[model samples]
Target chain A: MPWGKQETKPRLSPETIDYALAKAVADGDIVNLRQLFAPASPLRAWSPENIYSPKYAYLLPPSEQEGERLFQEALALVRDPDIAEHARAQLEKDGPPQLHAALVMTLADNAVRLGKFGAAAQAYEWLRVRPRMQEEFLRQGDTALDQNDIARAVAAYHAGTGLAYNYAAFPEPLPAVPDYQTRALILHADYPSTPENCVAMQDPAAFIRTALSYVFLDAETAARLDARPLEQRIAFTAAFVRRRDPDWDAFAERYRNTCTFVTAFGRRLAQDTPPAEAEDGGLAEEIEEQQATADPREIEARLLGRSIPEGEWWQYLKELAYEHPAAALFVARQSVGHGVEIVMPRLREDCPLVEPLGLDVTRTSRP
Target chain B: MNDAGYVDYFAALELTAEAKQGEVRKNYRKMMKDLLLSIGRERLTEEKRDRLLLDMARLNAAFYILRDNERRARYVEDRRRVIALEEEWRGLAETGGAGAEEARRQFDRAMRDFLTTYMEDLVLEAGRDRECVEASNWDRAHERHAGRVLRHDRHRHYQKILERLPFHEVTAPRVNWEERARVVDAILTEATR
Candidate 1:
């Protein structure tokens, strides 16, 4: 229990294993994934056009001179903490600069995952200093509420409302998303919530610290998202949804590298199963339950198809974020590498037209 | 920075203009003599003399404006018509830019809080290098820090909600609105102490 870089422990469940792999990439544990998948052919096609690229490794420089040059640039960046600070300062002095904010946050977040705590703190600290629309919101809230513009009012109300539930209720670690209510208004920075808009971040810790990230009225959204994840996903379905130009068939039929699997350890999970075809892993159990209970076809018809009207999927996500902040946090918090796999592959069965456009229905069987 | 002395140089001269030109010249001379006499004592250093010369120039400019009754009367009327109108542009610029800079400052403050909390347990490795006893106690501490981070992060996010507003720094602790009024006196006593 003395914590000085003890050997990594055996993963608890297949789900945990998937969580680890996803986390490896998210945490920038690129070499760890390579070690995990060392036996597999590295150059294999994750898709027809692309190789199964890993996040950790890069092409070795042709000359040591080139390597040294790259090293020096990184060294310069690291040797001075104020580089980021000054960059952020310039961004504030300038326009609504998105690139610096996103890049700094990502870089610092990635750095933390790579075990650079102090640097990460500085980066996060920098983002805290920018202008947000909360004051205009307080002034605007009265008019918005009076005007009967629910979206506008909701946006304003969140800026001024002093609800205390945000950090008082839930304590952390039991659930990935903690539950809490705000002592002040919940933020809505990216106001005019278009489909493309990034949701103004809420303090997940307010929920997590208070244990508010868990406990859902609907148990389905209660499914905890592993912050440290294993696996990769780029759903054709999501691409379809995200598309400004609504092209359905083009998305489903497309197949890309949106799948991940475990290496040698993954096959061991199947050992517990009677046969390769038998669905006995913990994942199978949940899928079986979901299939038996919540029909995918119905969910697709009601949620995704053209019938239920505009922002249907978007609304579902909002409701999920509202009723189950943790679940929303789970999705919100998802790193580029980790998340759930298709037990039933509802996107394929429901949106068959989309499948032909190249749906990467890669069943991430534990390697 | 020292724009204050230039005030009403011409107008003041006009206000007392009805006196004869000879008397006016005498009054101006007397005023200059007094002004010079007031600052006459010096270290006799060249740098000190130059500093006095700037002051002398400003007085001369004021007298030049005031010596003519017509111009002085116009200046006097102008002063009455407006309050501190000379430095209005600088004041406005400072107000606008400072407001903008302040919002940016607050946003950065909130961002740090978010990063600290979101990456808390992960970066800190809650169980590692942490001094404690008992698994349950460790768990509780982790949870406490973890939750605190989140709460702080939420505060950061709310800051973003208010990001565009002129930042009114609430240095006072969160107390009832009634208690807020007493804050100034409390602060004043502490400042003196």
Candidate 2:
């Protein structure tokens, strides 16, 4: 034979399809049932939803009338009370590999068509694809949420997403008159802030960063917060604040004012610093002299009416602000929109003026 | 109690304080049903949805206190204390007499107790945002930067929960304790005792 050998394929005729289904039902032959609904068989037309369509359009090669007749006949047989009872009894017993998988799939497809998604999902368990199960559940959740059925939505979301904790697990339809405990539980869940999960913040770094930038913490505590590894930030902050027992509003505001001073003074110092690089030769010496005169101690001495040799100004101011918030607040308040000259004159006599009078300076200074 | 720092639950539910238990229950159910129906019927924006949720939560809180006999009695008693204290403080400054200083000291203690209650309540309300982030598993929702933005939005939405609170008015300038104390002092001192 010059040509390739030809093999005859076994095709299922209508009579064979009918006889196979009847025998399977009567004998409880699930393997026969599997074969009938297998993708290679004509009976695969039964589930239109599972068909990929257009790309796998060839799967529906059977004419429309033929497909419909086969489906209607099979459905009628399965819907029969004696047959269904027998199939249920058979499913409970030990059976072939992938036993009744096709039977369950048919039931699922029918459930889907009837818009009974919950029942459909139950049937789909026989197919056993986890991702598909999750998708079905999430979809159900979204539907329930839209319908304003929060109880159903919460349950579906929990099942679909595998939430580690349930936020609101109150009784369904909500009791018309709940007991004290139930009301408390509902309030705890619905209220925006609960102490239930204080041990962990969603993003401690982001929160702490905001606090630091906003100057919601003192320089020392801010430094402490900065040094702590990412995970330990929230607990440390919560504990630190708890011990101080300071009113948070007052704390936040005091730092915010100090920040205003530090920022403005920092900018003034930046503008006064020698901008030209030291490598620029002759100007470098001039800049060095400028830095000398710019020194913080010299500025303080000059402010106190005592002349002193100039020194490095910018670095001193920054370190002073970082070390002593009182000095920063003092300079910030006195030197608003003015040069360093305007504020330093009273350091000797009015230095007592900056002694934090009624202000709680301990909050800003290092503990 | 149309004042900024107080909530009148009876007024919130559109009922007088003297409304019977049956009336309170009937109104709550009707309002809740309407709220839920509106949610279902409307295609709500994120902002609108948040507003609705907050309204629902506030409604729940109010109903919780009013529905119970013991809670309702306690709430009514607490409200009376606030009113009487405010009246006494106001009366001090208007009718300053021989014992004014002692009256002022008494008023200060009462004010601190009121402040403590409100501050704790505000903290509880603010803690909601953290709980929400945990529940939604929002940290893993997107890449780092995008996720942070979403979290910020979430926090801002939760902040509105605090804004709705009456205590925020009293603690408005949260930072300046000196000024706050002065103002509080002024309220009590300048009043006609």
Off by over 4 Å in 1: A1-132, A146-302, A306-367, B1-131, B140-193
| Candidate number with greatest lDDT | 2
**Roughly what TM-score does model 2 have, to 2 decimal places?**
0.23
CA-lDDT, candidates in order: 0.32, 0.39
State TM-scores per candidate.
0.19, 0.23
lDDT of 2 at A201: 23
Across A224-310, the per-residue lDDT of candidate 1 in tens digits comes to: 222211110112112212221235333232212112211211332222222223443444344445456532222322222222333
Best candidate according to DockQ: 1
